[model samples]
Target chain A: MTAPAYNKPLLDVRGLTIEIETRRGPAVIVDGINLTVGKGETVGVVGESGCGKSLTMLSLVRLLPNKIKVRGGTAVFDGRDLLQMSKSELRQVRGGKIGFVFQDPMTSLNPVMRIGDQLCEPLIYHRDMKKADARKRAIELLKLVGIPGPEQRIDAYPHELSGGMRQRVMIAIGLACDPELLIADEPTTALDVTIQAQIVDLVKELRRKLGMSVVWITHDLALIAGLVDRVAVLYAGTVVEDAPVGELFKRPTHPYTRGLLASIPKLSDERASRLSSIGGTPPEPGRRPKGCPFAPRCGLAEPICHEHVPALLSFAEEPRHRVACFVAQRQMMEAA
Target chain B: MAPANLTAFVDEDPPVSLWRDAWHRLFRNKLAVAGLVIVIFLALVAMFGPWLTPYDFLTQNLEVRNQAPSLAHLFGTDDLGRDVLSRVIYGTRTAFVVAIVVTTVAVAIGVALGAIAGYYGGLLDRTIMWFTDMTMSVPNLLLVVVINASLKTPVTAWMEAQYQATLNPFYRQTVWVDFLLVFGSMALISWPPYARLVRAQVLSIRGRPYVTAARALGLTNRLIIMRYIVPNAVGPLIVSVSAGLGTAMVLESAFSFLGVGVNPPTPSWGNMISDGLRVWQHYPHLLAAPAAVLGLATVAFSFLGDGLNDALNPRGSK
Candidate 1:
């Protein structure tokens, strides 16, 4: 991936391992994930369902579900290790320094609560603002999110708002304290296509205005195509390829990434052709194939690819792009 | 420009809260409104019984003894020569007090224990559920009888002794012993259902995305519970508590009828009915007033509970 144009690592996650306690034993769900988001940079984490994309972000905030344990990890945010922070320290960081916008706007907001109160929660708690001040700020936040008649809307409950409006409220809540980093986990996945584009646009506009680092987790490659500065493609919990968004689109080096890109139905394709799909599912948590987790699914898998796991290596020709594939690495090494 | 600008017209109707919405729905049901009116009437009678009653309940006149229903005495006089109307009015006070206190105690215990058990889960949950099951398994009337039979005399004697030693007028009120025993015993038996309901509620709510979102917002567990979990869980609780008030009143009456609840001079409907039962062939008015009032209360609360259940959970209604 290209060096942060901001030249400061806002969030650096290394060897972040997460395990879920299944009946069998502790199954490795997220195995040594390395993710970094620079200040003012929007990084899109792309992966299929159950590939630890959400889990990776959730674990950074120590918000993993019960029975899921973080075995090892160091998520350094602004020189502080988030994983090792005390409850009090984390509380200040959460919603203050690092805001989170969760998926499923319909369910993500407290249904019984007023949208204004929900928006004002982080403000009151993090900033310790007076109720009147918080109310004023809540209206401002609602206005900032482009909710019509913010004053009148503040008193409205979650059920009264449309899905798009509710998601906008969620975004408002995330941006409440003017957080340095906003980790939005597929915030627009539940919206309609038109609404999704609008949300992307709103986020793009907000990002330019707020100048905060964003880590957007989603399965939709095309949706985040123009939104993200860098893209880290995860396959079965590992970052198979990480590169600048433009470079990744131009030449997706990892087999899984290529397969993913191919799967996206293009307008240039024949109308009758069956939409290309990656064959077989990603390996299960407890039953990851030895060597590479993607080896079984890879069409160009060599005997050596099955024998040894490939490390993420930067191509000599394109130092900014990295690919975790033995075949891709060998091919690049031969060319160089 | 003004004609086209009409699209920006804001609807000025007040925002509808869940509680307000539920209120509107509750009022829509005819049976519920009737029940609410009857309950309100009963509550008013209970609140202002002393001022409203024509005669002092304890003041007896042999001349008016066993008088039939007339303008002077609406419900008729009992064999004791005591004004039956006044006694019935006072009985309303007893029922309301017993019902409200018992339900409050039971609900407090239930909400606290249930929230803890559901939120924490594991061993705490297992133990609490086990305790709840154990409490529910025992017969309610039997448990109240056993407690009253075992403790009533001792408590009254202790109060008498305290009055003698301290010269405190508070201890002289032995009727409080009857009330305390009834309240405690009834509360003990009544809390299980509430605990179960709230535990189930918290269990379901614990995994909701909003709760996860709340956690992500770094809201404290207490705040999350108070603001998020409790409000969502309270709708069913309100319905249950309405029903519970009725149940508590019925339970109190049953205890008083069995000579285990509020004693004489307190004018309880249960004891009055018990007294009226023996000579029902001669003077049916004695039984009719208290019995009718108790039945009315039970039905009122039941209808209100049903209405609340429908209102809170709109999906459950037509």
Candidate 2:
């Protein structure tokens, strides 16, 4: 693992917590989390469904319903705390500075509106440009995203375009304002492998061209491998481990991270038995273990691991590579 | 551009307009087309009925009162000897006007209230809905009847005053007062349901992902409603307007039949039915013709409305 000196973090989130008031009581969905995305760097957040990864990104935009509230946290992006911003103020930051490419391209786009009108809405609202200019920019964007006949495609509806084309259009819309940061939540998950690769490559190319920071939220470890600089592994609404991509994959300190890594099919392995699946269902919201949230299913869990929650301890006096497990930390230092 | 990709050129299809799609689907429904034709014909008759007929709708002759169907007066005559065919023709004008005005007003109020209530939840939604609920709680027909009844005494007094001044038979009648009762009362009663329908529809659509995308794009609430919310919610609105028109016509006709809509000396289909029913055995043709017009008009409007509802919503396609 190497430390590439960051210019400056475009987004720095610290002590972020999210909770929803249920009939039972206030259920914590996202535990205290800290992360940062350097200007122009891509940080991949990988986790299974219900891992609170989606909530983390959504909370940054303050898009979650009123039922879900940020219990405590500060999301400082470009000198402003996003949590403190009002609805109107947040709107300026949301699409203007921080672009979001949602998962379902079909649903994300208005089915009734033309591609041109949809693409130009952001320029009109945030940039306050003239319609003609917005339309011109939109055509350019569609072309940039590899859509052919940009002029004609601009007037097409969401259903008329293929899934890949729709996704490209979504990317164009997201990058319309040249946002400082792009939060892509499973942007390629719904697509086929070739199309997924195309989207990934397109994102990477766009990042290079625009030098924009991106938080690529996905469940695929393989997709995150070559794309992201750092990786954050989440389980049961908490980040189990956070480290540089190579280090996390090479020497995963968290058992859940290890299981997730091992779950990826390797080319060399030849086995008669079925491919490994993470045993047991993920712990539901309120029923989360009081100590280490992963202790119940973790085979490495000791008595102490069940008694108290382990702080995200460093692997070897190194602050950058951290894991939330006392047993895992001790094992790591001993091996070192 | 070297050999502009032929497949790519073909793929870039234009988005279909919602109005165009609605029109396309409407054409597919033959019954709706037939209904539209009837409604148009009825509208034309209403607009030009006065010019087409010689006998004034209000003119009455006690000497020739309650005549049966004859060669000269096609549909025969009412109790006052005012031609039933003439009155029914002019009544088309009243029905068309009342239906158009009341439906337009109702839909305007309903769509506004519904969109606001749906788009903005919590207290705003509840308050608007509570008002809708209060309106819906009253039996619509009974409420309109009471409202109409309250206006009658003043109207009767006004009619007496007009009769005293002009001494013309038609001026002494209750025609103008009845028109006011039908238009005003129905408009007041019809708006609540449409508001409720729009509110329910908006509530569901406002939370959809596209709406979220629109907000994320920093679209103003007004622009979002106008461009996104209204267009999506229009299928229900079209249905409401169509059915609402039919309902308004029936309400007006009922009031006229009750002698509270347009009074004696002046003739309407409902008033003719009221006057003819008394001498049913002798002059059955007088009641039959107006009744036929009312039934046919209602059925035509309903078919048109059903067709419109089917055609306007593309998602309605299986």
Candidate 3:
């Protein structure tokens, strides 16, 4: 329900809960969370590590790791509940309707396989393209991702390519079947700064050209500033703030969002000045606070903030911006 | 379409496939090269033993019953005056056949069971591993001896009955019984290690990011195992298989020497060495010829295995 500019949503997730089996028993990792991605809209899912950002996305595709599972969720992608789909139907959606580009390009790609073969796998399986045709399409995808010498590079293994080049190959593979939604889970986390910028720009350009909805998951608030249309700020497995990109940057409502944005160092600061950062890490999954998960870390927490969790509500004057913080609600416009 | 000028940086290096790279690394190893040469030479000898041997291995001449090494017979004559060189050459054929066939059978069984156990963990994994452990726990020699002792008479009798009923010459070769028992026992014992190795390999390889990536790509588990998991897990397997071949050859010789394997007149190196052992004081050539050849094959395989281990996992090498 972010911005509501594009009403027809491509993916609408509701009350998605995930649990991990620990030594004690099953513990809730991702509490009841709601998220949605509109058709041809780019949304950035920003959160720190272990905030259930990656796990939430992985659970939608039924790719959760061993001992971790979806407790309850209804992930309706293209008007179908993905969590309840048959194995065959899930196969059609995975890499067909919703593509994923994972983190750590160096390790994510199969080292022994040729880059072309890896890129062509989904096309051959889902698109039913012949190997020869798949190969041609693979070359085109490599070119589309801006890799040099598509013909020669097609035969090269993952190790033969540089890290940035490997990531490009990964993106090309994700985009192979022309999925409706691309969920990039910290795709630029492992790249050099310049390379990260290039990849972000490339994804932005690809999103424009293909007009596919993108869920760019990252902890860096600054990286996806220019890449995403709206930003959803997650804290301890729950969305604390959801707003248009420009509005979120200009007026970060949630304490967690403000902390995240403040953490990004600005150039105008003194040469020797210390970079601002959130003092404490986000709460662990199962050990999250009974009330507001961010109350312990927030500077402006009131008595009510400690006693009860704040619901995400839109401001009366600025209906597009939604924030989940009691102190902000009382200080700012009325919650409508 | 991409700009043509953007592709200018790709001219520096040529493409090299993994197989080619592994071969290159293998050839660079001096000990491995030597092993390869000896293995190839022995394989050729095994393939063309009949043509290469100067005399029939079973032929006996009383006059030259115990001759030393000479121009006529490079390895001299045994107690029966049968040319030792011909017998050793024929022995090479038996060793290679037993080694290759047993290894192939064992590897097939091992890879299949291990891959299944690994890909689908929990009860299936425990069950297969339990079976593998049960098989491996029993002493190999004791198992083979028991099998031969218990089953040989019944199998030979069955073969005779079949021959009598059908008038089929195929069942007349009772030597098939000895081979069947030996090959079956050796393969049964040999597979457990391969199973354990491949299982461990698959368990690790399946968790890799590439495998997860493949899963995210919506590939079936079978396709993931065959194309993705198998290729990556094959390096250590190659090393294990090479070592297993040598071990199988040695095991066959031991069984043959114990009279539980290939019977007499078959010219197995083990039986020849057994025949040579008692009369070695008078004619050392009898024992030396077959023993030396067995030692050479074992050493050659070991060297090749070590070389392959290093070459396949180059990061582990200095």
For each candidate, give its TM-score against the true structure.
0.96, 0.90, 0.97
Question: For candidate 3, what is the DockQ-based docking class?
Answer: medium
* Model 3 chain B lowest lDDT segment of ten: B1-10
* Candidate closest to the true structure, highest TM-score: 3
How does model 1 score by TM-score? 0.96
Off by over 4 Å in 2: A1-7, A315-319, B1-9, B12-14, B48-51, B59-72, B79-81, B152-181, B262-267, B312-318
lDDT of 2 by residue, A57-153 (tens): 8889887776888999899999899999988888898789988888888788887889899899899889989999999999999988888788888
Residues B1-318 of candidate 2 have per-residue lDDT tens digits of 112452444543356766787898898889999999998899889899979876777787777777777887778777777777788898788788888988888888889999998888889989988998888788867877787778778777888888899897876656566667777777787899899888888888888878877776667789889888988888888887888888888877787788666665555667777876787898788778888998989999999998988887657745
- Ranking 1 against 2 by DockQ, winner: 1
lDDT-best of 1 and 2: 1
Per-residue lDDT of candidate 1, residues B1-318 (tens digit) = 012232264357777788888999999999999889999999999998889999889988899888899999998998878889999999999999999999999999999889989988999999999999999999998998899889987888888899999999999888778888889989999999999999999999999999988888888888988899988899999999999999888888888898888889789999999999988999999999899999999999999999999999999889
Ranking by lDDT: 3, 1, 2
Chain B TM-score, candidates in order: 0.95, 0.87, 0.96
For A1-336, candidate 3 gives per-residue lDDT tens digits of 233347878899999999999887888888888888988889999998888999999999999988998988799999999999999999998899889999999999998899989998999999999999999999999989999888989989888888988999999999999999999999999999988988998998898789889999999989999889899888888889999899999999898898888889988889999988888888776687888999999899888888899988887777768999998888775443
For model 1, the superposed segments whose C-alpha errors exceed 4 Å read: A1-7, B1-10
Report the C-alpha lDDT of model 3 over B232-295, residue by residue, as the tens digit.
Answer: 8899999999999999999999999988888889989999889999889988888899999999
Candidate 1's displacement at residue B15, Å, is 1.8
Kindly give the stretch of ten consecutive residues in candidate 2 chain A with the minimal lDDT sum.
A1-10
Model 3, runs deviating above 4 Å: A1-5, A333-336, B1-8
